[model samples]
Target: MNRRPLPQIVLGVVIVVVGVVGLLRAMGLVDLSLDDLFSTWWPLAIILVGLAALVAAPRAWIGPTLIVTVGLLFQLDNLDLLDVAVGELLWPLVIIFVGLSLLTNLGTRGTDDRTINSAVIWWGSARRTTSQQFEGGSLSAIMGGIEVDLRQAGLADGAEISVFTFWGGVEIKVPPTWRVQVSGLPVLGGWENKTVPPADPEAPVLTVHVTAIMGGVEIKAGD
Candidate 1:
């Protein structure tokens, strides 16, 4: 399973936002203080985290939706738009929600594969099938990730894959001796080919055509 850790990026972004707010307060740009913002807007943190998980976990949305709804309720209460002790009841409800989400995830059939003909991931992870002979295909990812493990796969001569990514990333791990070519335009993004050089000049070729906008595509040599 390609479990791309999501919390670090989200947490780093949250930290930067908090730091910026602190800087503005120090510069006397706004009258509010950090503690004040935290007390009133902390629920938003919960909502953002839930959104990240919902997008990256590839699970049903029921759990994330409930968590988002609860965060909204608490936000409204903190804003004095509602009269409720949601903060006091939040932790217990969160515990229960975690249990429910776990139960829901237990129903999905997770498998390992390496060959992909076509796949779309909006906010999750996609893995290619493990077939040794791989045919080119199409992949699309928006705010998600796609991982292809080609260590056991062989390329049909001139095999090609078209990949489109927006605000997301794609990682391909291939055998050390495969010949790979990556060509594409990266708008506010990048393409990295870190595969080891092939042992022979007559090795197979697999071309990856990528369109990355505010995202990245990385080709790495597999262990």
Candidate 2:
């Protein structure tokens, strides 16, 4: 029972459903077409993705929450339930959400251990990790950037760093002796790992799990 497998499962189901509907339509068994269905209900997909992200990474809820909000607004507009245009209300709602997120620390939680939990919204941030027992931590950036210097940190075992970025970037600097493994989804965005692995196969590993939407992440070895 992995905590993050639901997203993948949901994606698989969506693909299967689309294929089945397409096949049924081609056979004249269904009146609805995929294009029409998607055009009318795409916002629901965004909301579902956001919900999955929340389940996948509860601590990094800032991006997911915003996504859910946007999806709801779009859906409401599609249904003609609002008095004003969604475009007119979107930015104001975003600003309000950002304010609330700042006050609530964007759902980031502090731990008693040396685990970094940071959130940057509409601003840039720079931090350095010097923890001797660096466990993993979560980092969230929305409409901002975060530069984390972890060269001074000593990883006793392995570490897992979760990063969520929306229209922002995150740069991580690691020690050359460490090995880096990065995995995650990026929508209209990407990540780059420029760490040259040391010859020792037993080098400590640092795993980065990221969710980036219209954002980027870069990791490299630094002094």
Candidate 3:
């Protein structure tokens, strides 16, 4: 699997463009001043991050899109271009969005749940499934935490899993020999894969699809 960070690339372009625009203004080649441009356009950086997240993983785009909408509204309000108070709308919209998100697909989700071993948690904090031979399963941590240790586990060539964390976090421990692929959209959150690639260079691939909102997911080398 291609491990290139697409979001980083997009963000780099945005930063470069903004810096170049500011330089042009300073050189008297543009109409707007540095302050005016920064104040009026800097919020776009946040919106673009959300957009990149949505593009990276469409399956869980709502969280990122909500973040984008809120940011845009706030920026407009700050620029005196909006009449209504966007702040008042934030909490209500967040509640509604969370409700809809849960109702839509809050299952023991995976590429194929019925065919794999798994563990899922909704609230509080706990974990399970210390399988010695894990073969691709879903792990969810919502408004809580979870830890999965699969150091001794085994996987087939194309095994995959989906992890969703909302206002929560998850930690995964995997064997060093596994070839892992991590993909996700993070809204006020992060997804990090710290597992080292095996020296053999022909390890089995384990694809992890994730959705993170106000939370985080991490993968670490184990055993």
Candidate 4:
């Protein structure tokens, strides 16, 4: 039998043991609180499972570790170790780390395959408008050769927009009546803006801000 199958067997046994333990506790054979199950014991189980998965199938560790970490973070919030708001803020970091790890693994595996590497581009855009407010959002490719294009996405009269990219190129075309702020360091390419002016007092203007790392960015005036 392959060494990979051993991890699955071990995982199954561990889960069965947990189920049996829970049943025994519910029947008064063992005394355990929900707090104990969630805080101290659960994290240990997570670490153990993470190790097991890493040994059995390295590629599968990302999902299990992510689930375990998020579950533990929520448990910490419940136990008052972390503020709810702080926990919420940190949740994205956890996801980002997992995504980065997954990407790193994929990159390593695809190093010899240029086609796979070049297919990593992604693009997205959104717009919102109302009587008192206008909003627009977009995210494009990240570091590497990714490309994102957002054209005329934002509130009509007055708009607030934010764009984010990691290690990639992004281009946005906005109405000529919008104000723009570009911030952050691009590892490779510099930022460029065309026809962007200071805040306009008389004209209803849209505000656009972009954040990126190690990438090229271009923003242009449009209809």
* Candidate 1: RMSD to truth: 10.7
Candidates 1 and 4 compared: the better one by TM-score is 1
Candidate 2: tens digits of C-alpha lDDT, residues 16-93: 998999999999999987887788888998887777666655667777888898999999888888788888987887
How many steric clashes does model 4 contain? 6
- CA lDDT, every prediction? 0.64, 0.78, 0.67, 0.47
Pick by TM-score: 2 or 3, better one = 2
Per-residue alpha-carbon lDDT of candidate 3 for residues 39-151, written as tens digits (9 for 90 to 100): 77777876886677666654444556666888798789878998889878887876776576555445554322332322233444333344444556555555667676666
* TM-score versus the correct structure, for each prediction: 0.48, 0.75, 0.65, 0.35
TM-score of 1: 0.48
RMSD of each: 10.7, 4.4, 5.3, 19.1
Q: In angstroms, how far off is 208's CA in candidate 3?
A: 3.7
lDDT digits (tens) for residues 1-223 of candidate 4: 3232454467667779888888888899988775667555565554554444344323223333443566576556556787565456665855575465446435332212211111123333222122233333333343433332233333445344443344556566655765665443222345687855746666555444443434566777763
Predicted structure 3: lDDT: 0.67
Can you tell me which runs of candidate 4 are displaced by over 4 Å?
Answer: 1-133, 143-158, 196-200
Evaluated at residue 173, the lDDT of candidate 4 is: 62
Clashes of each: 8, 0, 0, 6
Q: Give the residue spans of candidate 2 off by over 4 A.
A: 1-9, 12-16, 19-29, 55-57, 76-93, 100-113, 156-158
Cand. 4 TM to true fold: 0.35
